[model samples]
Target chain A: MACVDDKGQLTASARKLLETIENNALTPEEIAKEAALPLFKVRSSMRDMKSMGFVTEEENGAYQMNPEASKLLKK
Target chain B: MSEETMSQVNSLPRIGSKAPNFEATTTHGTLQLSDYEGSWVILFSHPADFTPVCTSEFISFQNIYPKLREMNTELLGLSVDSVSSHIAWVRNVKEKFGVEIEFPIIADLNKEVAEKYGMIMPEESSTETSRAVFIIDGQRTVRAIIYYPLSTGRNMDEILRVITALQATDEHNIATPADWKKGDKVIVPPANTAEMAEERVNDDSVECIDWYYCQKEI
Candidate 1:
């Protein structure tokens, strides 16, 4: 998410993160630990995903992929 | 300094230039600059192996080695000394100061790598290299350069700061402010057009001191 190019494609790191998050709702820390990425990376990824309406933050600050994003990304 | 020597000193690779590639004998054996292609490099030089200032700098560099590695940055040290000298110096540092120097030190006895990197200050001592640090990115492009007089030791904090700042800017596509460290708010580039500048101030996502200066957390 942080390295998005001019063409608006997800960066390799972001893709790794997204693929790491499949079907799972998790906090940034959890996602980072699970994905074996840094916490700041997960935070940036979640922020970008949230801005793009691809993810939503729960009351506990955990994030989950939106149905629209899942369907769109499924393509 | 002589005219010829001054010209040699000033001939260093500028920022954004490709790093001069080299393969030389190191404490760890023969190594090449290209071996570190997929990682960031902090290629540095010191005056000699057993000098006081250089010894302190080496200890400090070893202190920050773990942190640098976690950030995918490697440290490369060089001096116009022989490999045996480097090995003895590393052992001496460990035995005397109890801090092991793990990074490979290039034994540039022929001054090939030193001259290529402009580490040899003919003015300082043709036989020794002055303190020089080059930050090279994963693509082998020189990202930043710092030169320090041989008398003064390098600041480990500043070295860490520069690495952190450089990595942060690249990853987030933002610039760092003066005295910026990790977790500090980062500078957002100014808008390119007049309309964007007006909209930028009102965007509210970033705090702006003026239309030209805006900062946001990453």
Candidate 2:
């Protein structure tokens, strides 16, 4: 799940999850389906997204977007 | 070298001021800034046509064009590329992307318009224009300006946020706070007294963070 980027060596699946969430909100299953990654991998990515402070999961199980996430999609 | 440097330094346009007028051949025809007299203007510059980032940005803008027009705002896209290049790109946008960009895209082949707007920044691009956005009011005064680095694309949401903020400030004579979006709380200017702040928080619909920091729904 780790890889090197121009920015740094980071988690590959996490980066993939960030890419998926950049365009739209998705649950773990939806992220797995869209990314073609495994369920565990998607969960890992979601965890990474949380750690990066790019997304927040609401109590209702819905995910909320942050300003950084919005900016990333635009970029 | 000093004189050349000074001249180059003097060439950049200042933001929050009057946008210089220019005439350029667009997809629709020749366009002048004066023609959009009674409407707000979103004058945006792109790096190039037929590119991925530019394509997505154009499509997104076109998709929201109707909403923008409803706000009495007109869009004017610009790049240093030629008019034919722009036309082909517009056609491709409609045919391939299924989005129509009805707005006129200014073709500044000579970089005249680009230089006038400080769109041609060598630090960002030596051979192309950078992603620059300018929001001009109905009176043709620059209200807000933004620039994106070459590797980064501009945010349509942030663009619209700035426009909405400007409109709100003009309408209500209030100021927007950091990361302000539509329907979010806006800042109320600091009153000299805590009593005034408490009164503001209690009397206003905005959520009060503290006595000094009062926010209201915009």
Candidate 3:
């Protein structure tokens, strides 16, 4: 599980990936490119975030920030 | 395959490019490039089997096989020869020269792997591949590519030396001087700006001939 803090913030690589992901559902490749991070790093972080319920995978293989996590971020 | 694919495969793959993948029959059975992932591989091609020069090269490569294995590297040979021909040639070498061929040889009857690696030399012999060597690293990147005319054989010691240099350079993040071997001091990357160069010179950990060029022991 990712070390998400009380402020709904992910730590280390998970935090970097969470910051890159947006609500419109971006593919991991696009996120990696936008963040200038390696594809493997993006993919591994995505896997961890998805399992931790901080992110969601869409049917088209793109990722979106979970609505609950998004709400928490706003607070 | 399209013209783009033809151009990509027919041309010699450049160093540092991802090695072109292939699956083919070998003396050991069905083999694929992916099978050797995470291990250094020396993929080489000979003009033909049972020839004197090729026989000597094969013997030399076999002699260094154990050393290469100690370095976590594998040897793979290729030619535009059939499986039965490869088997017969390997058996003949063992019987006549008393050298057991332990490594697998690719049976590239259709020149499949040859075209992918641009091993076939039409000028030398339309049917046979030239003596080509590609040193692929554990990450599947082509580290080095060497070619010798069909008449000339390769130096296995030189190949081993190259692998050592590559591994050392990667591990130490330093460059190897020409003809460099293990335990030799390695060349450090030159500083970028004037301020860094000043700092580099005063750094006692490294010996600098000048502000730019430095040598260090790893």
Question: Which residue segments of model 3 deviate by more than 4 Å?
Answer: A1-75, B1-6, B9-11
Candidate 1 lDDT, B145-184, residue by residue in tens = 8989889999989999999999888989999999999999
Candidate 2 lDDT, B1-218, residue by residue in tens: 69976786676556567778876777655567866665799999999999999998998888777888778788899998898999999999899978888888988899888877778788657779898888888888888878887778777788888888899988877789889888987777766777886687676565677767777775
What is candidate 1's CAPRI-style docking category based on DockQ?
A: incorrect
Where in model 1 is the C-alpha error above 4 Å? A1-75, B1-11
Q: What value does the lDDT take at residue B151 in candidate 1?
A: 93
Query: In model 3, how large is the Cα lDDT of residue B206?
Result: 96
What pairs collide in candidate 1?
none
**TM-score of candidate 3 on Cα atoms, chains taken together:** 0.71
Q: How far off is each candidate at the interface, as Cα RMSD in Å?
A: 15.4, 24.0, 14.0
- Give the Cα lDDT of each candidate: 0.84, 0.75, 0.83
Instruction: Kindly list the per-residue Cα lDDT of model 1 for residues A1-75, writing each as its tens digit.
Output: 243556666667666667666688888878878988645346656776787887899999888877766554453
In candidate 2, stretches whose alpha carbon ends up further than 4 angstroms from where it belongs are A1-75, B4-11, B192-211
* Model 2 residue B212 lDDT score: 70
Clashes of each: 0, 1, 0
